[model samples]
Structure formats: C-alpha cells, structure tokens
Target: MYALEKPQNFHRGTSFSLITRNGDDRSETSDYTSEDEGTEDYRRGGYHAVRIGDTFKHGRYVVQSKLGWGHFSTVWLAWDTQKSIYVALKVQKSAQHYTEAAMDEITILKQIAEGDPEDKKCVVKLLDHFKHSGPNGQHVCMVFEYLGDNLLTLIKYSDYRGIPLHMVKEICFHILVGLDYLHRQLSIIHTDLKPENILLLSMIDPSKDPRRTGAPLILPSSKSKIVSESEVSKDAKASCSDLTKNQKKKIRKKAKRAARKCIGKEEADQDIEVSSPEASHRDDKSNGEPSEEKSRNSVGENSNNDEANDASEGSRGHKRGSRSARQKLLAEVELKCKLVDFGNACWTYKQFTSDIQTRQYRCPEVILGSKYSTSADMWSLACICFELATGDVLFDPHSGDNYDRDEVALGGRYSRDFFNRFGDLRHIRRLRFWPLNKVLKEKYEFREQDATEMADFLVQILDFVPEKRMTAAQCLNHPWISVGPRQLAPSMSENGGSDKKQETDEREAMEVRVGNMAIDGAKNGKDSKSMASPLKQ
Candidate 1:
C-alpha cells in the first residue's frame, strides 16, 4: 500500500518519501498472490530489521517515524505522499483515555478550524482523520500540521531569564489573539496555559532553515530571499548576547513603531496615508544615490544598526506587523491549554467551583468560597506569566504541616491557608469534610500575610466572592497587567516582569446546564456522577 525510501536527491537523516494510494479499491487477489513472494523478498531485503521506519497507508497520508508520545496518543511524522508534504499523525491508542477521548479532541479541533479559520493560526490545523483495525481491534488517527519544538524548551534555554520584554509582548499578543477567538468566537476557556503546550511553528533545530523555523523567523525579502540553516544558527547565537546599550536603543525604536501601530483604530486610519506618503518619498530619495558610494556608506551604518536591532526588532515590520500576529499566537496557546488532560479537566462550572485550581494559581474567589467565571483563567494566566518571567512557580505549598493528599483534597489548601492567613476558618463553607477548628489546628506557619497580600493585589481580579473574580475582559484592563506590577518587566529594573479572555461563554453555558442537572437530579432522587474519592479519585 505504501513505500519508503531514502531518496538520493534529499539529504540523509530526515527526508521525504513518496506514497501512492488507489481510490478505496485494492486488488485482494493480488494481495494473496503476492503474500509469499512479498515475504521472501522482504526477508531478502532485510525489511523486517528496518528501525524507526513504519508506514500507515491512510487515505493519502503514509505515517512514518514516531515523532512524539503523549499519555494516550503517539504522534508520527507522516508524509502526504500524494501532496508531497509532511504532516503529523496523532494515533489514538486503546488506552482508557482514548475510548472516549477521541470525540473531545476531534470536536475541539474541528471547532477551532471551522470557527474563524483566519484567526486559527495558534491552534494546530487538523487535515484528516482515519480508522484502522489492528491486532488490538479498531484504532483512530488524526493528522495535523507538523510543528517543531514547543515554548517550554525555549524557556528552558532562556534559563528562566524569561523571554525578552519585546518577545514577551509578542508572545502575549499571540496568546490573547487566540484566546479572544476562543472565548468570544468559540465560547470556550482554555482553562490551562503553560509553556509545554505552546509550540513553535517551525522545528527547533540549529540546522533548520531560518525561513522555515521559529515564531520570529525572518520572512523572505530582497536582502535574503532564502535563509539557510547556517543563518539561523548565527541568529540564535546573536540572540544570546546580554542586552547591550545598542540593543536597548534598537528595542526602543521598535517599541515606538509598535506603539504607533497599536495607537487604536482611529489613529491608525488617520495616519495610514500620511506615513505611507512620507515613507515613499524617503525611499525614492534614497534610491538615486551613486551605487558604489552609497554602498560603502551603507555598510558602516547598516551593520551597526542591524547587529543590535536584529535581536530587538527586524527591518521587517515585525514590530508593527507582529501585534496581530502575537495575539494570534497567544490565542493558539490558550486554545491548546484548554485541550489538556480532560481526566483532570472539570467539564462544568459547578465541578470547577467545587474543585478549584492549584493553590498557587487559584483565584481569591475560589479560596474564599466565592463564585468564579471564565475569568478564573486570568489567575492561571498570572501564575504562568510569573513562571515564564522568573522561571519559578509563584506558589507551591510544600512546607509547614505536611498533609497527605486525602487531607489536602478534602479540606483543600484554600481552607488550610485561609485559616492560616486570616486567623479563622469560620468564613469557609460547603466543603465535603473538615471542621473549622480541626482545619485551623493543622499547626503550620501558613504564609497568610503573603497570600492575603497577593490576593489583595489581585483583588480587582479575584474578589473575596465568586461573583467578583475579574473577568477576562476586565483583566485585559487590570492595572497589574496593563500598567501595574505585571508591566514592570518593560519599565522596571531587570528584576521584575509581567504578563486571556476566553472559554467564558461556553463555560458559562456548560456550567449552568451542569448546575441545573445537579439540582434537578438531586430533586428526582438520582445520584450524580459518583463523588470521586479524595485520595483515589
């Protein structure tokens, strides 16, 4: 059905192979006739010993090497032999997660693709899906655009220095764009946004062509039409230098350009013609200089400026053009963050209410037993933002009284930290277990002051009551993010740094239905989904 070869025309190690498939018809008789001959030939050719080479003859894709592995799926780097392109084949294993997981994955993929395809850059593109019967029974597979490494590795290489402020701005913009699409357009909350899940469009390799790699790769232009792998390696090396005066100057210039572009729709439309006319005049004047004389002068000036600005902003309108691009990337990250381990995902609002996020990132409302909205995503975003900036989790309670999982699960770090910080646990209610005194009695030096201060700082975000947790829209305007501590990264000393709106609508609707189901089902004397155990559950 498919063939694999190390094409002579292409480089070794990794290269494309051709595959051909007929229209849903196979010569069955030929299969029988060729079986014996094929087996003998396969043995003679040593085909059985081929390592890291396997083929899956789907409609048109022939999946090849295993590219990655998740808990429930294995992704293969595949070839759309008919189209002559590479793709990723995510094969769903027959694990417990897959029996029911495929539906959710497919639904999210299709939803993201069909809903505003133009804004779907952040989300992986699903090209096809197929089913095959194997020794274990039937299996499912999905094909997506092949992406290289993820942001996590990039962050790792940064040594937790966090991405540069300009880069962070770009990253934030992309994430927000993706999130805005998901929340408003798709009515969904990513509910999760971390480094690992955010992937780069190009593969992370020093040997990859610059034009074919990274979120900030240079576009094809007159200066260099084709960017080879060596050029990318050079760029990466240059990017490693500490921020110099020249680099800062270049960054400021780029920032100015970016600020102009983001100066609101009214300002943009007003200046569109004005700026273009002035720029056009400047280009025309510059074109008439004596070629040799101009070239000699240009070398000194261009090298000095380009070397510094290359890391901060390119000659490309990356500073200006990247605003929308960044938003799209952020939106993509937010979307994938939503498609995480559903086993741990709360499918409804009520479930989300009862089961809050990890203590470090939990919104104050959740801590105080107040209501929450899709805006709860803001709290998680803050947590991740801090991590990206500082390379350390904001809150990981591993100290004080060591409580087991059961104790932590039943009573919650909220209850424990609540009393520790507030000097009383009486304000908390509706927990499955734990008396007020017992909760307070867990002798530990809870960082109540720290928690309270942190919460107070985020108060505009997560109010003491659930109804008050900041919405994603409100968060966009929050002082901390827009102009406060989060904003410190750009203006403050190298020490500080800062950092979605989505999944609110669908989550609100989902929450309401789930809540109603719980209420109505309770009245009818029916059991809800079994209350999972604190420890085992």
Candidate 2:
C-alpha cells in the first residue's frame, strides 16, 4: 500500500513542498465551520496552507493538528520538536493588510514581554514568529505556548452552566491583574476582551501535558466520563486505521486538478456567533475530533479540541439569549485564567478608537460617544465579572431595530441621561440607575451580601462619566476583589499589629457601607429586571 503524497498546503505563500512516500497515509478535509473555524474566517475568506504533518522553520515546529479558524488567522497545534514541547501557531492570512496587523500584534507582544520579566501574572506568552510561504499566500505566523480551554469553553462544556463563585473570584482576580498591567504598566488597552480571549493558564500544573498525565481533567460542573486505558487504546487504533485507509486511497490526477481550481473559493464570511455555545458544533464536525451530541459524554475527550469548540463563541455577542439566561453553578473552586488577544491594542495616549470594546461589554462612555480611558476596560471587566458570576451577559442589547427594544417595552428606556463624552448630558436628573444589586439578586439569585459588594464594586466603574469610573488599580484594592479567605495569624507585632488591625476595620466598615448603599437603592429594585444598561449613539 506504499504511495507518494505531496504536502497539502492551504496558504497562498512561497511553496516548499515536501513529498514523502509512506505505506499508509490519508487525510479528511474538514469543512470550515464558520463558528469554530480558526480565528477570523469571517474577516478573510480562503483556505490556508498549513496542514497536518506540515513542518516549518527547518523542522523546529511540526503541525500536530488544527485548533480553530478565525477571520484573520487559522490556529494550529504544532509540536516544538526543537524544544520538546507543544505550541499553538496563529497563521495569519497571506493578505498584506492582515500581515500588517500581525506585525502590529508582534510589536505589542514584544513590548509586553520586555516590560514583564518573570511572567509574574496571568497573560498569554508569545513564543516565536516568522513568515511561511504557502499555496494560499505568504502567511505571517505567530507562535504561542500551548494552553488549555478558554472560559467560554468551560462554561459551554458544563451544559451551558455557570462556574462556582470562589472560582469566579480567582479567575476575575487574575484577569484584573493582567488588565491592570496592560492599562497601567504597558500603557495599552486590549480592544478585544472576551471569554475567547481569556484562556485558562493550564488544566493541571502547566509543565506536564494532560495527554501524558494519563488522567483527564474533570469539570465539577460536568462529571467526567473517564474511559479505561483499554478503551482509549482501542479508539486510538480505530482512528489511526481510518486515517491510513483514507490516505492510501489515491485521488485521481484529474480530481486533484479540479480541486485546485476551487481552492479559496469558499464563502464562509458570516456574523460571528457570540452567545451560542453549541450552535456551530454540527458545522465543525468535518474537522478534527468530531463528536456528536449523543456521544458528547464519550471518553477520551481531547481538551485542545474542546477549546476549539469554545473559541467560536468569541464574537462577544451583545445579547444573551433567553435560554442562556439561567445557569446552574459548577462545584469546582481552583480556577485560573489569562487574557490572550491584543491585536487591536493601542497605547493609552493613542487609542485605536472611541469604540474599543465588544458590544456586550461596551461601557456607557463608549456607547454615548464619550472619550474613554482605562475606565473603559474596567467597565468591560465589570460586565465580564457579572457573566462569570451569573453565566449570562449583564447588559445584552440586541442588534438593529431590536436594539434596546426590551427596555423600551418595559418603560425603562432612559437613554436621555447619557452624556455626549463632552460633559453635556442629554438630560440632567432625568437619568436613572437600575441598582446593580437588585439585578444580581433578582435576576441571578446572588446572596444579599455578594450582590451588595459586587454592585458597589461595579457601579463605581459603570458610571456614565469616565472620570467617575473606577480604575483597575482601584478595583484591585476594592474589598470585594481584594478580600480572600480569612485566617488567624500569629501577631507580627506585640502591639497586636495596629496597621493590619486598622486595615481589617476599614474593610469591615466598607462592607457595611456597601450593604447600606444597596439598601438605599431598594426603591430602584422595581426597574432592575426590565431596565436596559446597553445603549449606543
């Protein structure tokens, strides 16, 4: 069954075809499901040159598998043979404009790396970058350390469930630290901040690969369906057998020529699906790690593929569907996450745009066409925190004619209070705030205390005025985000640690003030549910 097969390069770049003869070789082409395709399929419509077994940079990294597709780039899980590790390569489209964008990102990443020496906090690390000439075009590829699932993947995998509170705090804390670093130290703003951009630091102790660990990570939200070693061995052999059979079946020379004629002719450009977790699963089945709904609980689930399944929801849809409004909580507690994408990142003095954030997480100032600073990121952070705590978008405003239609229907449309970013309000004293406490308590069933503190924390940033908004540094110092497990410690000072004691007193007093504030806004509770927070000029 020996046969010769030329490398199936998909990109439009310089070709260095490696033809190899093997006894068995076959590959099935997966239809690019727009949702789960590698990043930016909606931006650039075409086939890329990267393929399974494709080696780059003198065989430093060999492609193991594809991760997902995007409009701007396609991601692949490649093995760093030179370093004896796995890495994710983001292969940009060969288009010049996109290549320019990739270069911008590379410059930003270099700045970030040079700014932070030890990787002290949680942020995706960029490893390497180079250009690869392929069939589609000359692709500028950026390499990243291989990571596990994004937060969205974790949520969807839990049967569309929300995560635990303690875990949420942990995840949010790390995100704030990263955001703080970006906003303060780096003087950069991450224009795109969503679940898809926030990746898990690792499934286990990052150094060890999950595949080599011999144990799969089980989410507390969904009980793990562990497969015995024998079953996994059987499935592996079956998959390999199927691959070899397909590879050995030769494509007629005429068929190959016909296929070449249609390369990059596929139109997969569609609006990114933001709220639906399982919406694109059917469309993505043709690609790697195919799974059906019925076999969803099957054993030997590849975590990397699971990440691909989740990355499609990165569009950051402005509306959380009615079905996803209610979410059951997971039981896991040890959660860690890191912010990843920074393609649109710009300096604080020079922002990319006044409209820098995703629709769902856009701040009031941005929506009102006001000048926004780092406070804009804080607003997005607050929205993300709410989603993490409730498993739903906090301020989802539908698009087109339906935008803010829900609020208008409930007599809660209060856009008149918006300021024009120039300190001129549409109406003074006419603006009303639907207390965040009631939104959390009534809508998501958060405890009174949790709701109060979180509302107090969020309100300070979700303000109409950017000047009134809380900074990332202030957020880190807030009692809600700063508070951790209380423990009895031996007195460092014989005087009963007066400074520590004073700090505790202040924290407790702040907590009391937070509760009082929520109680004061109890009258606004009536409008919390139907009230709309999302508005656009």
Name the top lDDT candidate. Answer: 2
**Model 2, CA-based lDDT:** 0.51
All candidates' TM-scores? 0.46, 0.60
Superposition error at 325 for model 2 (Å): 22
* Poorly placed runs, candidate 2 (over 4 Å): 1-33, 38-47, 157-161, 204-334, 399-433, 484-537
Name the Cα RMSD for model 2: 19.4
Clashes of 1: 22
Which digits, one per residue and each the tens of the lDDT, describe model 1 over residues 181-274? 6555666655444444455555333333223432121111111112222334445446646887787667656554554343322222221111
RMSD, every candidate, angstroms: 26.2, 19.4
Instruction: Report lDDT per candidate.
Output: 0.38, 0.51
lDDT at residue 451 of model 1 (Cα atoms): 25
Worst 10 residues of 2 by lDDT: 290-299
